[model samples]
Target chain A: MEIVIVSLLNGLVYGMLLFMLASGLTLIFSMMGVLNFAHASVWMLGAYFAYEVSRFIGFLPALIIAPLLCAAVGAAIEVWGLRRVHHNGHVAELLFTFGLVFIIQRSVQMIWGMLPMPYRVPAALDFPLFTIYGANFPAYRGFMLFISALMLLAIWLMLKKTRIGLIIQGALTHPNMVSSLGHNVPLVFTTVFAGGCGLAGLAGVIGGNYLVTESSMADAMGPIVFVVVVFGGLGSLGGCFIASILMGMIQTFAVVIDASIGDVLKPIGIALSSETLLGEILTVPMARIGPLLPYLLMVFILLFRPRGLMGTRDT
Target chain B: MSTTLRAGAMPAPRSSLVGPIFRIFLIFALCMALPWLFYNYTTGRHSGFMLTMFSQMGMMAIFALSYNMLMGQAGLLSFGHAVFFGLGGYFCIHLLTAAGGGSLPVPLEILPLIAGLCSMLVAIVFGYMATRQRATAFAMITMGIGELVATAAVMFHAFFGGEGGVSSDRMIDRSLFGLTYSQGVQVYYLIVAWSFISILAMLYLTTTPLGRMANACRDNYERAQFMGYDPKFVRFIQFALSGLFAGIAGGLSAITYEIVTFDSVSGALSANALLMVFIGGTNAFGGPILGAVLITLMQSGVSLISNSWLVYVGVLFIGMVTFAPAGLAGLIAMHSPLQQAGRLKPLIVPYIRIVVPGLVTLIGFVGVVELLSFKTIGAAQGKKLVLFGNPIDATTAQPWLIVTGMFLLGGLWLWREGRWFHTLWEAMMADLKPKKGAAQ
Candidate 1:
């Protein structure tokens, strides 16, 4: 019971964080029709920025300032970098962002050194919030959850209630129409791009401390964020959220499930040794393949439902 | 010259092959003589480094060309191309090991072919799934497949050999022409021979009906569909054929290095292939060849100086994407119009003006990069900041002030001068309009 409850909570926390990152990517991808390959790197920059800002000021101020700075960088990238290559084609845009991943990651290294930064949870939120069967759940997690929930609410209110939000909604579903319908499409694109990057920054500020604030963190998170975006389907934030939580839960649960195909086959009187490829496949534990699940899910989704679960447009 | 006008098109078929065939032969001759040239003239002896670098350039050239088959011909932006290359290397090494153990009797000459076939096999399976979609969906699927294979390589130790990867001796029992594959020169020649064959084969493929159809699909998918060509089939075949060449490159890498690591199939290498293809200019056939060699030299040269060379590569890649989407080849090809109009000499003054400011801006950027990189890494290593053998203090405000000032001022000046250069270029181009009209 304790294992189940704790895993569930941990999975939720991870799911929320994944959603924060993936939501931005999905927004940019849906609106701009180019996968921002440097999205995760921007999130990394957010964490680095927060680290620097928090060092100079406090954690609260860093939390606000870092995301804004990320937004500004996102604006610059969209306006200066992406706009020039827009005429060249989508491939050029993707390559541009892909190159940015290397530049941003190395720049982070150049500034912060090769080692992980010492970004920590605030002292105010460092203590345990609750215990499930003697396992402590930190107060910092509650803080993370609150921030994510607040962002979600803000995103929902902005998209569904406000005028700019409605335009954003139109852009999400009927992007061509949004451009054709006398809207400031370029402005909308820049805003969406910046806002998405800001959300990723917020995730970084929170997740940097939750996980290890390392140089490699971007690479580790990049593919998974892609998996979430693709699996949830393009142009669907609801699907993005669903896919993230589902992936989070699956990963969280798979780590503890020690069963293999061999174990399943054992009851069927089909014993397999570790001599052959098939045997090895059968004998390998689920925990070992936990990291591969998102990719597998992404592949399966792309194969069966190219539009994704809740997508209106085909990716 | 006419081909340069249609820059973002398929490789131009030569009406008469006499000149091109002669050039091809000459290029191959150069490749064959390169090892000896380096051995006797420059180094006074065989330099393993030169041989290795040459061999690497050959393989990467093949890899980049294969990548261009998908990106340039089929319009498929695949992020997982190195899967074939890396897997091809792994298979070739295994083949080499088998030959060493007296089981496989195939000569070293045929191993690359076998590896290419093996790589094509994987490409066929993955291509089936990937080619099911086009554009972004296709790219995503490839990315997934690549990530899957990469993860599996680390997960299963059966074929991929886990983290330590697999290694084999290049000095296998069997050799061609009764000569043992012991010397670096021998291996280098073997790679060169294969590289020539692969290049010729790919060049021939560009003139084929399938290649033309692939280009047609790239330009207009619906039109190709109307013309009764299945776009997916074209992409699949192109992907597979490209995989064959990629695999052959991987085989060459295996023979040269005699070891394959998980890094071989990593996303980084995949990105490296993309960088090479794009930097060379995807439109022209020889573009990737230029990219492959330039990148190989840069990799060998720049890596010795700084661990942060990837940042430079990244910046270069992004810069190319933004400023020169057609690549270095494209920039050279762009000069054909000026040369044709006999107006090349007129733009010299404007070009010099732009070039001077560009150099200043570049130097400033380099200074900033050095200072920043030195502040972190150089200090960590307890090494003093040195530029052109002059000891410098990174902590000093003077260098920082000069670098920032130069960067900002030079950048502004360059922008203004660049606009003026563009105006002069336009005027030069306009001068051709009336001459062409009168000729018509």
Candidate 2:
């Protein structure tokens, strides 16, 4: 019971982190049909920037500045790089960003060096917030929950009440109609792209300190972000949120459980040896399978529903 | 759409003369003579690098060409092509290890075929599911399938060997003519022969009804449907055949490296295939060959010189996408008429001026990148800082100034030369006369 509750809390934090990344990716993907491969890289940059800023100025200010920096870079990439490639085709745009991933990753290594940075939880939120059944909940996690909830509320209010948000929703569903309405579709694209990147940067700011701030964090988190976006469906924040939480839960729960096929088959007298392949597979702990869960879900979702969980179109 | 531009015209005598058979022979002759040419002229005693590079290029050439079949001919861009390639490689390694353990009698030369067939079998299963939709849906499904297989590759130890991967010896006891195949050059020759055969086979496939149908489907699926063909079925077969070719390449990789790992099916490799195929030019059958060779050469060579090679590649890929979407082949092909009309001589000076500045810019770019990367990654690791074979401090004003100066000067020179180059090219294209009634 204790384990389950702890896992739930951990999963929620993870899910919120995923949501922060995926929401931006989803918005950009929805508004502009180019899947930004460098979105995760930007997130990584945010983390590294936050680490640096936090070292000099403190954590709260670092969080604000890092995401702003990310937004500026994102807007520049949109105006200078992607806009030029857009005329060619979607594949070209995708490839252009694909190239950006390598550049950003290498650039991060160049700036931050190979080793993980010494990013720590802020002193104010360093202690335990509470304990449930002897499993202590860290204040940093509470902070994360607060931030994510705040972001969710802000995104919701903006989308429902703001002109840019309404325009984005319209563009998401009817791109042609939006263009025909004489709105500068390109300007909207740049704004959404920059905003999405800002969100990713914000996610990175929290995630980097929560997990170790490292050069490889982008690469490690990249596939999971893709999984979340794809599983949730492009252009659907609601779906993105749901998929993020589900993936988060699946990953967290998978690690704590130790059951395998052999465990299930124990009563049926299926004795196994380490030398045999099947036996080896059945003997491996579920904890090690944690890395495989998100990918597995992605494959399952893609094979069964290419458009994603709640995708309106076949993206 | 421009009346001033002489495109959609008769392709000219140069295209006719360079015909399929002639090109094929030329490629084969070059493949054969390359090793000896390098052994004689270039750096001596490092023939190992040459053969290794040669084999790697041949394998990647097949991979890229197969990718072009789908993206270029069939117009379906797949993001997860490494699935088939990796699958083929895994199976090939399994077969090689199995043979090493004495369960088969087939020679090493025939092993790639078995790998191809296995890849085809897997492709058939996956392609059926993937081909149900087109465009974005197809891409997503393939991505999903790729992730699934990659995950499985790390999970299943029997075939995939988990994370450690599978390894085997090429020197199995069985031989057709008692060739042990121990030497790298021998392996190179084997790769060349297989590459030639596979390329020719792929080219031949393109000329067939199935290939034509695939193109037709790509151009306009609605029109293809009206013509009594199922577009999905055409795509399925094309996907499967492409898988067969890609698998052959993977088989060669397995045989050459004597090992297979999850990296074989990694997203990086998949992206590499896309880059090679697209950069080479997807408009022509031979485009991927050019792309594969150029890209592989850059990857292996440039990586040694600069850590920011990925940045260079990113810049090049973006440039190609924006300015030359038709690719390097298309750019080359656009010049055929000028040569045929004997009007190429006037453009030589402009070409050289452009090329020289471009090379300078590239060199400067490489230098700056190397300097920065070396300062960051290399300096931290305590690696030597050698410039012109002498140690030079990176923090010194001289090196920094030199790199900075080169970047600024080279970039300015290249920009100035680019205007002249474009003017010359546009003038040449405008001067050509288009023949009446040719397909656009």
TM-score of each: 0.96, 0.93
- List, residue by residue over A136-216, the lDDT tens digit for candidate 2: 899999999999999999999999999988999999989889999999999999999999999999999999989988878
| Residue B87 displacement (Å), model 1 | 0.5
The candidate scoring highest on TM-score is 1
Clashing pairs in 2: none
| C-alpha RMSD of candidate 1 | 3.6
Q: Over 4 Å off in model 2, which ranges?
A: A265-284, B1-18, B40-46, B387-391, B433-440
Best model per DockQ: 1
Candidate 1, residues B1-440: lDDT per residue as tens digits?
22322333445566645565678889999888887766765546688888889989999999999999999878899989999999999999999999889898888889999999999999999999999899999899999988888888888887888999998888876877766878888888888989989998998888776788889989999997776667787888899999999999999999988999888898888888999999999998889999999888889977776667888888888889988889999999988987987778877888889999888888788788889988887789887777656777888899989888888899999999988887877787788788889999
Candidate 1 lDDT tens digits, A165-261: 9999998888889889999999999999999999999999999999989999999999999999988988889999999999889989889889998
> What TM-score does model 2 achieve against the real structure?
0.93
> What's the CA error at residue B167 for candidate 2, in Å?
1.6
Listed per candidate, the RMSD to the true structure in angstroms reads 3.6, 5.0
* Candidate 1 local Cα displacement, residue B175, angstroms: 0.6
Q: What is the C-alpha lDDT of each candidate?
A: 0.89, 0.85
Worst 10 residues of 2 chain A by lDDT: A272-281
lDDT of 2 by residue, B11-74 (tens): 3333433488687988899898788866744444437877898899999999999998899999
